[model samples]
Target: MTKDQKDNLFLLVKSLTKSEKRQFKLYVGRLGVNQDSKFLSVFNVLDKMKVYSESLILKSTDVKKQQLANVKAHLYKQILISLKLNPSHQNIRSQIREQLDFASILYHKGLYKQSLKILDKAKELAIVNEEKNLAFEIVELEKIIEAQYITRSISNRADYLTVQAKELSELNVITSKLSNLSLQLYSIILKTGYVKNEEESKAVTKYFNDRLPKLELSKLGFREKLWLYKAHLWYSFLMQDFLNCYKYALKWVDLFYDNPKMINLNPVFFLKGNNYLLEALYFIKNKPKFINKLDEFYTVVNQSDFPKGENIEALVFLYGNFHKINQYFIDGSFEEGLLLIPQIETELIQFNNKIDAHHKMIFYYKFASLHFGAGNNQECINYLDKIISNKSLSMREDLLCFSRVLNLVAHYEAGLDYHLETLLRSTYKFLIKMNDLHEVQKEMIKFIRGLQDIYPQDIKKEFRKLLEVLKQYEDHPFERRAFLYLDIISWLESKIENKPVGQIVKNKYLEFYA
Candidate 1:
C-alpha cells in the first residue's frame, strides 16, 4: 500500500472506535473487491461511516454531549471535503451529514422548535440506515425539549407569585388567603411528573412554603394538613409562645434555604424581620435575662438583602424597640433617653406616611403616647390630629377616645385649662360622629363633678347636657355605657382627693378601655 493510503486508513481507524474500526475494514474490502461497481461500493462505505459517527455522538453524556454538535460540524466539513474529492459518494454520506449538522446547531442554540424538526429528519435518516439506537436517541431528545418548555412555564408562574405576596404584605394583610390557589396549583404541578424527580419536588416545595405562610392562606382551599401548618404558626404567634414561634419561623427559613430560588422570587425581608421581632418581644416579656438577644434579633434584619428604602416598617420597628430599651435604661438610672429620640421620631414619621389609614391610626396612637411620655405635648397633639383624621373611623374611634382621655389628663397636669376645654369639645364632636354620645356625656359629667370638688362654684348648668344624654341611654344595653360611666366617676373620685382608684375601679376602668 502507498504511504498516503496507509495514513488515510490509519486516520479512519483512529477516528472510529472499536466497533467502527471493524465496520471500516468491511467497507474497505467491499470497495477493493468490487462487490458492486467502484462508485456504488464507495458510496456504501461512506454511508456506513456516517452511521458510525452519529452513533458515537449520541452515546456521549451531558458534559460531552454539549460538545457533540461542534464535533459533528467538524466531521461534516471533512465529509464534504471527501465528497468533493469523489462525487460518487454524494447522495448518501455528504447529504445526510449536512442535514444532521444543521439540526445539532439548532439544538445547541435552544431553538428547540427548529431543532426538533431537524432531529426528525436525522431520525428518518437513521431509520433508513437501520441504526435503531440513533433513532431512539433522537426520540428521547424530543421529550427533553418538551420538559424544558414546561419547566420554564412553571418558573414564570413562581416569579409572579413572589411579586404578589410582597404587594399583599405592604397592604398590611400579610395573612392574605389569595396565595392558597397558587399553592394548590404548585402542588398539582408537582404531582404531574413535570418536576422530574424527588429533588425537584423538594426544590419547589421549599419555595412555596417560605412565602406562602405570610399570606392569608386559610380561605385558600388548601388540604387540611397545609392549613393546619399555617394555623399552628399563627396561633403560636398569638399565644406569645416564642419557642413555638421560633420553631415555625425556622421551619419557614429552612424551606427558603433548601430552595433559594424562592427568595429570588418573593423576597419578604420585613416579614422575616417581624418573625425575629416577635421572638424578641416574647423574650422581653417572659425571659428578661435574655434581653441581650435583642441585638441578635436585629442582626437578621440587617443581614437581609431586601430593599431598605422600601422596608420602612421594619426599620421603624427596630428603632422603636431600641428607643424602648434606652428608656428602660434611662428610667432605671435617672438619665436622659433623648440621645436616640430624634432618630426614633424620624423613623416613626416616615413609617406613618407609608402605611394606609388603618395602620396609620395604630401608629398615630402609639406615637402620641410616646411623645406624651417624652414631655413633647405638641408632638403628641400633632399625632392626635393624624389619629382623628384617619379614614378608618370604625377601627380608630375607640383608640382616639382613649388618647383623648390621656391628652385631657396631661393638659390638666400642665394647668392648660384652654387646651383641656379644646380637647373636651373635640371629644364631644368625635363621640357624636361615632354615635357614642352617652359615653362621652357621662365622661364630661364626671370631669365637671371633679372640677366641682376643686372649686365648689365651678360646677355649672352646661354640664347638665352631658347628664341628660346619659339618662336617655339608661335603659339601653348599657354594658359599654355603664362601664364608661363608672370609668369617669372613678377617675373623678381619685383626682378629687389625691387617692388611688381601688382594684374594683381599676378593673372597671380596664373593662371600659377594652
Candidate 2:
C-alpha cells in the first residue's frame, strides 16, 4: 500500500466535501458508460476505507493490481476536472484561462478574426485582474494572429504589442525577484527561526538589499507593491525588527484594502499579512492596535462575499485559532485560553495534513504556556513533552530549546524534585549541543539546579533574585527573544509574589494600557 501521505488520490478523495463528492458522482454519471465504471468503483472503495489499503481495494473493486495505478490516475484527473467545473472554484484567473482556451481553438480552426477578438477581451480582463503573466501570454497570442492576418494598421499594432510586452516583461521580472527573495527569507526563518546575533543580522541584511529590485514605490502597481512589502516584511522578521515588520505587514494588508478586489482574489496573502501584523503588535506589546486589527481581520474573513474553499477554510481556522489564543495571552485570561485547546486540537486533527509539523508544535508550545499560566503545571508538562519528543522537526530550533527550558520550569513549579537533577543535566547538555545556552536559560538552569540546596524559606528570595536578573535581559536586543517564547519574568514574579502567572500578566497588561 502507498503511504497515506503520498497517496494523492486517496487524500483528494478524503478532502472532498459532501457537495463536491455529489458533484463528482453526477459528473461521472453524465457519461452513460461512466455511470458504473471501474474507476467509480475504485473511488467508492477508496473513499469508504479510513486509510489507503491496496489489498482491501483489490478485494472490494474490480480493478486488478496491474491496472490499479491507471485507474487511480484517471479518477484523480476526473475529480480535478469536476472540481474545476464547480462554481466556487471558478475565479477571474479561471475565466481568463477559459477565454484563452477558446481563442486557441478558434485560432487553430482558421478563425483569426474571432480568435483575435477573444484574445483582446481576455487580455483586457487579465490586465484588469493584475494577471500580468497571463496578459503577457495574451499579447504574444495577439501578435501571432496579427502576423498571419496582416490586420489593418499593422504598423501601430506591432509597436503597441512590442511596448506592452516589454513593459509587462520588466514588471514581471521585478515581481519574480521580489517574490523569490521573500520566499527565501521566509524559508530561512522557518528553518532556523530569527537571526541570532549581529553577524547573522548583517548577512541577512546584505542578502535582502542585494536582491531587492530598485523601483520607485509610487510607480509600482498593486501586485508589484504586494511582493515588495512581502520581501521587506520577511527581511524585517529575520532581523527581529518587529516595528518594521509591523510597518511592512500593515502596508501589505492595507494595499489589499486600497484595492478591494484583491482582498477576495488573494485572500490567503491578505490573511497572512494580517496574521504577521498581529504578531508584530504582540511582540511590541501594542495591545490596543492588536485588538483593533484582529477584530478587523475576523470581520473581513467572516463576510458573505469572502472567498471560501478548503485551503481558505484551513487558513482561516489556523489564523483564527492562533490569534484567539494570543488574545487570551494579551488579556492574561489563561483559564479562558484553556477552553480553546479542545477545539484547536479537534481542528488540528481535521486539518492535520494541511497544517505543517512546525506550526502544530507552535500550537503545542502555546498550549503549554497557557497551562503554565493557569497554574496547571502537570498539563503544561504534558504539552511540552509533545515538543520535546518530536525528533523529526527541523524548523525552529529556538522553539525546541525553549520548550525544554519551559519544561524544566514547569516541572519545578509542579514540585518534582526526584528527577529535577536528571532533567537539569539532560537539558543543560541539549542546550549546549544546540549552542543556545544564553544567559536567560543559563540563569534559569542554574537557579533550578540549586533549588535542592536552598531552604524552603529561601525559595522566595531565589525567585526574587532570578526575577531581578531576567529583568535586565528583558530589554536586551538579543536576549529578549527568549521572553517571546515564554514570559519567564512574569512566571518568576508569580512565584515571588505568590500569585497566579495569569494575574501577573494581566496586571502588566493593565499597566501598559494605563
Candidate 3:
C-alpha cells in the first residue's frame, strides 16, 4: 500500500545507519525473548525492504495482516528506546534528564536524600546550560521532596525554591514570547517577502511593537538575549532595514562566540545566525566583510567536533554552497562560478530528500543568473523555464515574479523573442495578479514591450535612457528589492556598451591593479 510505504515506521527504518541497525539488534539480544518476537520479525523484514508493501510484509514475517499494525508500532517504539540509550545520542540535555530520571526512581523508593542530591546537581546543570525549562521541573521535584520531608538546615528551603521557580518561570515566558514573534516574522518574510509597500510596512511594524515584550537589556541571560536578537533580526528583515539586519545578525552570531559551549550545543541556531550575517553582508554589498565571514563560517562548520547529524549536514550544504555561489555573483566572476555547477548539481541530487523545493528553485535561479551574466542567454532561459513551468510551486510569489521578468530578458537576449508580445502580456498579468508590479518591474516590462517598435539604429540610445530611468530607483526603498533579484542595470549597461554583463560588473568590482 502507498500509505504503508509512507508510514513513519518505514521511514524510520530507512533512516537508520548501519551501526544503529546493529545496535537495535544487539539491544533485542539483551532480552533474548524479544529476539523471536513478532515486532522483531517486522523490524527485520522492514530493514531488508527496499519499499514497504503490506502484502510483502505479510508474506515475509510471521506477523499476520491483523497484527501487522500493532507489531509495526511496537517495533517503532523499541527502535526509539534503543536510539535513546545510544551513547552517540547522549548530550548535556540527555545527561541532565538522565539524572532527573534516576532522581525520580530514588524518590519513588523513599530514598529522600539520594533523590534530593541528584535533583540539585541536575538543576545546576540545567541553569548553567540555560535549560531553565528542565531546571524548573527539577525544582518542582525538589519542592515535592521537600514537602514530604525537610532535608536542610533551619533556613527556609520553601522560600528559596519559590524564588527560583518564579524567576525561571518569568524568564521562560519571555523566551517563549520572543521566539514566537521571531517565527511569525520569519513566516511573513517567507510568505510575501520584504514589506512591499507602506501599508504592509505599517502593519508589520505595528504587529512587531505590539507583541515584543519589554525587558531590561542587562538583566537577560544568554538564552533570553539570543531569542531577543533573533526577534529583532527577523523584524529588521521584514522591514527591509539592511543596516539593522546586519546589526542584529552580528549581535546574534557574537552571542554564540561569547559563549563557546553553546555553539556545538545549538549548532543549527549557530549556523542560521552566521547564514543571516552572510546574507546581510551580501545585501549591503560589503564584499570584504562577506568574504571574511564566509570563510569563518566554513572554518567553524568544518571543525572536527561540529555536529554531524543528517539535518545539520543538509543545512550546512544549503547555506555553505548558497553563499559560495553568491560570492561569485558579488565578484562578477560568472565564468569561474560555472565550474561549480556540475559538482553542485551532483550534490543536490544526493540531498534531494533533505532539501526542499524552494531551495532547489533558489539554486536554479542562481544558476540562471550566472548564465545570464556570462551572456549564455539560451542557457539562462533553460534554467528559467524549469522554474516557470512548475505550476505547483508555492514559494514566495516574488521569486516567481522575478523569474518571469528575468525570463523575458533572457529570451530577448537569446534572440528568441518572436513571441515577445505574448510573453510580455502573460508576465505583466502575473505580476499584477500578485499585486507586485512595482516601479522597477513596470519600467522593465514597459521598456521590453516597447522594443518591437524601436528602430535597430536607436536601440542603443533607448538602452541608455532606460538605464538612466532605473538608476534613480537604485536607492529607492522598496524598488531596490527588484535589483537584488536581477541586475537589470548591469544588463542595460552591457547592451549599451556592447560588452558582456559579467565583464561590465567585473570591471566595477574586481581590483585589477592590486
Most accurate candidate by lDDT: 2
The local lDDT score (0 to 100) that residue 74 gets in candidate 1 is 48
Assess each prediction's global lDDT (C-alpha) against the native: 0.46, 0.91, 0.90
Model 1 TM: 0.38
Better by TM-score, candidate 2 or 1: 2
Q: For residue 336, what is the lDDT in candidate 1? A: 39
User: Where's the lowest-lDDT run of ten residues in candidate 1?
Assistant: 326-335
lDDT of 3 by residue, 422-501 (tens): 99999999999999999999999999999989999999999999999999999887788898899998889889988888
Top TM-score model: 2
Tens digits of per-residue lDDT for model 2 on 386-465?
99999999888899999999999899889887899999999999999988888999999999999899999988998898
TM-score, ranked from best to worst:
2, 3, 1
User: If both were scored by lDDT, which would come out higher, candidate 1 or candidate 3?
Assistant: 3
**How many backbone clashes does every candidate have?**
5, 0, 0
Task: Report the C-alpha lDDT of model 1 over 172-221, residue by residue, as the tens digit.
Answer: 23323323534454344322212323454565556555645444443321
- Model 1: residues with Cα > 4 Å off, grouped in runs: 1-284, 287-293, 304-309, 312-339, 347-364, 374-379, 389-395, 419-422, 435-449, 452-514
User: How far off is residue 221 in model 1, in Å?
Assistant: 14
